[model samples]
Target: MNSFDLSIETYLSNIHFGHFATLSIQAIDNLYTFKGLVLIPVLWWMWFQQDECHEWRREMVLATLVSGIVALLVGRLLTHWLPFRVRPVYDTELHLRFASGEIKDAVLTNWSSFPSDHAMLWMAVATGIFLMSRRVGVLALLYTALFICLPRAYLGFHYPTDLLVGAAVGIAITLIMTRDAIRVRYATPVLRWTERHPAPAATLAFILCLQLVTQFDELRKLASGVMKHL
Candidate 1:
């Protein structure tokens, strides 16, 4: 109704209309599936295995995972609790259904459309990974943009602006949490504790806890899928 909403609606309608959207939706979703779930983690593990930052790696990994989860949850809450923007597909007068049956019904999510969750989660993980390695971060961001963010727009699930804002929120959260001063301040007590304790055991326990938390969503999804199949 206001200028911003009007602008967003107009933009969504414009982008959701043709051959481009058809190509982008499928392409982006597939990219998200492959890059987010498979490639990034595999690459992270490979790199992490060879990492020399033994002291810093565990701390950074813990910070990244915790901060990333918080960012994702905040983003989801903001999108869901704020104004409920409709997806382009449901705006019938807009007539933006480009290709029929190309998108999965499960993906045709009925949630509020502003601030896309896929974009938020991808950006969060990308930001977290970026804190570990700049080169890897850049690749992660590119993967998010090309495969996750772009496809959401193409598939009529989100406006370009939604992805942009979601990404900003994700990155902002990561930066706040992983800033050097914050890290030093938070890690000081933990470091002191480790100094008086078995450092390796403490670090291992910390990493295991983080690994479990980080994989929670993926595991839940996998379990749900398995249950449905059964």
Candidate 2:
């Protein structure tokens, strides 16, 4: 790590000031992994059958999912192909700079720390929400940065550069997915196919979501391993 990256990593790692704050950050860390997916339920609850933009919202949600998947893939490839870096808690040099008695999970091992998959997912959804509604998007972006991003950094699961690069990848993927050319060339055809076989499409989406929530870690590790060799 360079001087700036190490400095920020050191500063963030020392942020678990008190017991209450430590507990809160830990809770946020757990919640952060699913913050993006949480939007799915919110959209479902808020979706209106007669709304003029109903189709837009529906399409945006699918686009967000696809973009997140693309970001995940890109991040995994970079992480595996790039030089490996250690997490703060596991970094011998950085551990000395960490605040003791807070958020040290044994499972937080040293790994490829150039980019964070968690940030990619959260930012992808945040960007998608922005495209759908400006007000909600602004709020969501702030919420993601403050709650999800900060907690992960404070807890040492990612470095500042990791979060920054992951978010850039995420925003890029979502922006590309938002492009008219991509939508016309790919998304429209897929949407038309789904419309003709709504039941099957819905079933597949449901199954994919179910497996994601239940076996996320397992699948992620497997994907990383597969990507590493590819």
Question: 203, model 1: CA deviation in Å?
Answer: 14
Q: Per-residue alpha-carbon lDDT of model 1 for 1-230, expressed as tens digits?
A: 34664465566445544677565566546543444564346334633464577557656655665566676678768866898777665656665553333344553455677787666766876887777778877888887787777666655667667788888887887788778889767655665566578678557655644443343456657877999999
lDDT of 2 by residue, 43-105 (tens): 444334458877767677677667767877787788889888787666776654454344455
CA-only RMSD, every prediction:
6.0, 3.5
Each model's lDDT: 0.64, 0.71
Model 1: lowest-lDDT 10 consecutive positions: 98-107
TM-score: which candidate is best?
2
TM-score of each: 0.67, 0.83
Model 1: residues with Cα > 4 Å off, grouped in runs: 1-32, 39-52, 100-109, 184-230
Question: Which number leads on lDDT?
Answer: 2
